[model samples]
Target: MWHMARPRKPLLSRARIVACALALVDDEGLQAVTTRRLAAELGVRGPSLYNHFRTKDDILDAVADAVCADVDLSMFEPYTEGAEAAEGAERAGSTDGPGAADWQDALARWARSYRAALAAHPHIVPYLARGPGRRPSQLRMADAVFGALTAAGWSRAQATHIGATMRYFVAGSALGSFARGFVDDAELYARDYPHLDEAHLLAEYQQRVDDGAFETGLRALLAGLAQPRDD
Candidate 1:
């Protein structure tokens, strides 16, 4: 007698599951994305998820990694190929001492890319404060920061400190943006306070704006980092 073949495993993999989890957080918020909930959505039992991921934290880490992957690392490079090639051409044509270069612009670009990505995945911003593993992607990001600082003539130690300070500020600001109500509940507050009503905190008609708070803090942090350390 021939036995019926078992159903092939679903095409779903761990990464897909993590992506689904990210969407759950993005749409319904993080509290809605428990392992049991995800398993049901995936058409698998709760324990089945453990076959792909050992624990809830493991799934969370994968989600953070997935979000961070959205940032473009090449743009964080100290000099893009085009910039480097142009510099080479400039050296060939002129006898100038050296072109004025500022690594702050590159670092600012890196911070902007980081803030934009993390703000989009606000739930995952916390994990970045804990730092990434010693993987190739993580190393590349670290290298990019270091490369930018070194190009501006900072020592290794100074560059490391500068990179850490920038990362912390970006992650912290993203968390703040996420806490601001998706639809600000100004109406509730306005009922009690006249000033709140006058300010129209819930005004959606205004053009969407970032308030530039993140960039402002970034500049402040850089100013501090550029100062001479007492120790």
Candidate 2:
């Protein structure tokens, strides 16, 4: 009797499992990611998932980490000096302390990249807002931000505030769209809402409008947090 050859690779895997779960969340919503639905999506029995993830939350945690892994932390790299930082260098008139403009440029780049990652998977934004929660990629991002800030002259507590403030702003921006909140009904807004005469056009201009808002906010935020401590 010939026995079935085990395929070169197992059909079920942690990566496959997480990918499928992420797809489920992306296609439907976070609530749609139950183990049964996930198993159905993966073409496996429900119990099969337990071999990799112990609970649904475990699967979600993995999904969250997977998203986190997409973020770019390279702007925080120390060797950035004399290259792009040099270009941004003259932009800073401050020789008062650590190069604040370099930090500002790094932050703007990081913010844009971070928002792009979260924007690609808007449905998962709620899960990500909960913070790092022991996720490796999330933890690494946090480390890079804090380390870079302190190295650039922020005290530990100030670095922590900057990190938290960035998270709040970025997460809130990614959570939903201001433009989409308005219905595209010109007639409806024309009468009662005087200022919203152009509001009806918002949804159609959603991406452009939202991108402008994020950029404006990011600029203001980086400026507000710009630091060259006196002490």
Candidate 3:
């Protein structure tokens, strides 16, 4: 009897798998990300993927962490400097501080960067409903936000609350527009909803996009948060 040659191990790695999954999500949307699909893309069998990730949910969680890692810190870097000080130290400097700034402006920039990242990976937003603690990069991202806020004359307790609020707000903001297209971005019946028709709601779909909504909400949040708190 002749001996058969064994199959070679694939060129795949966990990082490659995660990256490919993200790209698939970006191009065709998240629903396209399946182990079978991913394996096919990697030129391996679906079972080979399990050798790296246990289940689809595990892969999704990893993808969420990967998405958080992509946030742009360039805008938020200034405020994060000296952001890790103790009470009355005048700064919060930690070489490891989140996103690199120590003021609300820094936080705002950080928020925008985060929004951009999520917008790029819309499929991963739903997984964030559970919040950031589950993933290492997300938890680090959260820590940076809290650090920046606390450095800006906000208390640690207050910073935590504000950070939570911002995370929820940004996640919702990115997803809201995505949800809109889920129904229809086209015209509705003019006979129905006279007020909406009169307002030209259907025609100016692009204009209807409130690009400033995030800034407006951020300003409002900071203004309210900066005020003296009973606690």
Candidate 4:
């Protein structure tokens, strides 16, 4: 009997499909990620992709999850439980202060990191904003934020509200660039608005202007939500 030996590895996989799909999404918008286009990008046949994902949406789900995986969730570790929580809190405090880190500080770190991850793939934000769905990483992120808040003295309802609020803030921030929308035309603003004198320079310092705005807004939001709990 002549038996042919099998190849050491398969020609395609779910991970490869997702990586290619994500790259396509990052390069083009979600609409650009068709099965044919994905197969073309991966140097494989369209049928090969079917071996991994049953549909284009499934591929997108994987890509969205991959983006969620990039978000840093370590900030919530401090609010866990027991001795581990104490150590994590100490580490967080070491970064923000000499005392145990406050819940505000933990959330601030998480929000900044989340915004950064989304900013890197602004094209994918719309799809991600559709909600976590069955994405493990996205769900895990939601869990961490809610759990940390409840542990830090907030009621369950308050924790849910805070999580939703922070998510909205971060997602909105990454949806589009505020500074980049401004034009470097001092004359335009001078004749009309009469106030935006330095508006012309905003385009040149887009990063600084936008980052400062995010920090300011983030602080204000957290402070506003800091009132005594009703629940």
lDDT of each: 0.70, 0.83, 0.71, 0.85
RMSD to the true structure for each prediction, in A, is 5.9, 5.6, 5.9, 5.9
Whole-structure CA lDDT of model 2: 0.83
Model 4: residues with Cα > 4 Å off, grouped in runs: 1-10, 83-101
In model 4, how large is the Cα lDDT of residue 99?
31
- Tens digits of per-residue lDDT for model 1, 1-231: 999887776666897799889998888776778998998888878888888988887887788777777777765443544346556777799533223445677677778887788888887666656778743455677777776665555667888888888888778877764324435666766677756564445345322434455656777876766533433
Q: Candidate 4 on 54-134: residue-level lDDT in tens? A: 899899999999998999999887666533555676777743222354789889999999999999999999999999999
Instruction: Report the alpha-carbon TM-score of model 4 versus the true structure.
Output: 0.85
**What lDDT is reached at residue 118 by model 2?**
85
Off by over 4 Å in 1: 1-10, 78-101, 134-136, 178-209, 223-231
| Candidate achieving higher lDDT, 2 or 4 | 4
Q: Which candidate is the best by lDDT?
A: 4
Backbone clashes in candidate 4 total: 0
The residue pairs found clashing in candidate 2 are: none
TM-score of each: 0.69, 0.86, 0.74, 0.85
Give the deviation of candidate 1 from the true structure as CA RMSD. 5.9
Writing each residue's lDDT as its tens digit, candidate 2 over 1-231 gives: 999998874599999998988888888989999999888877889999999989999899999899889888887785334334544654775333333447778878888888888888888889988878888989999988887777677788888988899988888898789999999888888999988999999999999999999999998888787455743
Give the local distance difference test score of model 1.
0.70
**Candidate 3 stretches greater than 4 Å from native:** 1-10, 27-32, 74-102, 178-189, 198-208, 228-230
